[model samples]
Target: MFKKGLLTGVLLFGLFFGAGNLIFPPNIGVLSGDYFIYAISGFIVSAVGLATFTLIVSLFTGKGYQELMSDLIHPKFALVYLVALYLTIGPLFAIPRTATTSFSIGIEPVLANEYKGIGLSVFAIIYFAFTYWLAVSPTKLLDRIGKVLTPLFAGMIVLIIILGLQQLPHSPMNVASIDYSGAGKAFGSGVLEGYNTLDALAAVAFSVVAMDTLKTFEFKTQKDYKRTILFAGVSVASLFSVLYVGLALLGNYFKLPDTFKGNVGTYILSEMTQRVFGPSAQVFLAVMVIVTCLTTTVGLVVSISKFFNTIYTKFTYITYVRLFCLLGFMISNFGLDTIISLAVPVLLVLYPITIVIALLVCLHQLVTLSKVGIRLTMGIVTILSFLQVLSTINGFHYFKTVISLIPYHDIGVPWLLPAVVGVALAIILPYQKITKFKNNAEEKK
Candidate 1:
């Protein structure tokens, strides 16, 4: 149990700690500046807390994402939601972004202007090809990633943190930025920043991978497997929180105008390593980024392909893997900016629904919320999310203003009240007793 839990925890960490994980928190740190602690406190809750909650709910379901959603919402919605979820995590945005991030941070800076495009093209091919090879066989995923790659990844991250701390001055030199002026706004910004990591969504998608890997351990009962997942989830949450704090501090250390400019968290990391340990450390940083990105890419491909093949078995799993990998490779060549720009709108719509689902799933286990309540809550949140999305389009200024009035709306999470109302309506509707009484009557017959 100990060994399996340790390995599983590391695997979960690897899957969660990908391109965004490496880049975003540091930027958040710089933005938060001297208020890094207060801001990251909020960041950790939304980021790490969300992932842990997702994993625990998945464990309780003892099933992958399919049944988890199907039980709560209509099966039809489950199918549609899962498809969108998989696509977002797999080829459409995430998979390509990994390659682009790795290229921009790891390879792009080192190359001259003339060679950048070709360099990324060549890198994408090699990266996805290797990801395909690993993902082609999902059963060996634990052996390849959990037992091997994750430790190396974890080690490098730790080394980067340690070396970074060694370089910090006797005191902080930078002033707190106005972006995080007060604790409330700072905390809110941190919470919003967590969205960039997308671990909350990935946790659900990766639950399938975790379940499949757990089967190999041959746990005697479902309860045991869930217990193992709980252990792993705790470990993952703890590790991620620590790393996020460390990375943010490192970002704060490099908060000077020249170093902290633009979306260059990776470059900041590389510069930090080189300054502390010498130019040789840049190789270590690049290798670490590549491995972390590669592991995450492989896991996403495996999860997407395996889930799809199960539903549409006409194409073998490997074939789906190859197809997805091909699509990812093609999309990756478009570079990071394009992938991110396209992703923002979709994620804005998707994340609210995902968060509501995670919350409802956990809430249901503790309280007897009716199915109607769950459905209503999701429906209301979904509609509000759509309204929010539509407001971004042309001629919707009035709608956007209306949504912005919701509590915490300015921070981009306006669906909380709607979700609460959904639960309240579900409670007041009398649907639970009606459904129960109807079931009892039918059983008597």
Candidate 2:
């Protein structure tokens, strides 16, 4: 049980820890500056806390997140949410961002300046080609990502963080905005930055993969398997906490100028490698980034392909895989900056709903919410999240005035209070016979 749980945990970490996980810590580290500890504490709360809990919900319930949502909400809403999440977390955004991010920071450093576009295009093809190759063989995923890439990626990240920490920062911390100037604000900044990593969404996508991996092992009872799965979630929380702190500290150590900045996090990391390993830094960092992104791309590709194929049997798994890989290849060529820009609005809307769902689901285990409660709470959050989406656009400044009335809106989470209100309202509302329900408490959990 110990051996299987530990291995499963390692793979879980590999799936959750990629792309945004790679980029955000240091970016927020620099942004947090003197208050990094406070910032990272908040970061762990959202990133590790939410993701671990999300994994646990699926693990203990023995259901995929999409399935869980269907059980909790209307099947139609669940379908819409699942498809949107899969699109954002798979082909449309995440998978391609992996290619663009790896190329921008990892490969482009070694490319000839004039051939940057050509370099990105070439790298995208090769990167996705290898990703598709590995993804086609889903059976090997645990060995390839968990046993091999996870350790190698961890080693490289640890090497850079440890070495980078030995030297003091090149310059003072970057000036933070009003939202990051104090302990509270710094913590909020960290939380919001962590939220942007889009990991909680990945937790939902990857949960089935972990469960499927567990089925391959022999367990005496359902309880035993559930226990092992919970252990894996805890392991991921522990692993991410350690890595985020170290990486944030590394972010604190390097300060690059504006002219030199590409992706702030990537450039700062590139600067660290140059100082530590000199001329070989580019190749080494490139290898690390490639492995980090590859591990995730393979995971997302396989998970979504299996999911789409199952949900809509009109398309074959192989057909979906090819389409996703090809689509990812096309979008990645737009570059990392463009991809990030496109993702921001979508994430803003979807993440709040995700958070509410995760929170409600976790709470459901303690005491079941009536159908009215669930619907009302989700309704409030959905509206606010859409408004947040609009708030990010031009000529939407007026939305801020209304949003500002909400507590903690400054740090980008305006939905939190409203969600709480919905829950309270649910409790206050009259309960009807049809609203009565029970939680998914299988096997005495």
Using lDDT as the measure, the top candidate is: 2
Check candidate 1 and list the clashing pairs.
none
- Where in model 1 is the C-alpha error above 4 Å? 170-178, 220-223, 258-261, 390-395, 432-445
User: Cα lDDT of all candidates, in order?
Assistant: 0.80, 0.83
Give per-residue CA lDDT, model 2, range 1-445, as digits (tens).
Answer: 8788889999988887878888888888777767777888988988899888887887787777776676677678888998999999999999999998898878887778899999888999999999889989998988988899999998998998888888765443666656678988898878877876778888888988988899899999988898898788878898899999888877775664656646778877878889889989999899888888888898999999998998999999889999999999999988888888888788888888988888777776666566787888898899888887787678998886778888878777888998998877655656731222233443136
Badly placed stretches (over 4 Å) of model 2 are 169-172, 258-260, 425-445
Best candidate per TM-score, number? 2
Predicted structure 2, TM vs. truth: 0.94
RMSD of each: 3.0, 3.2
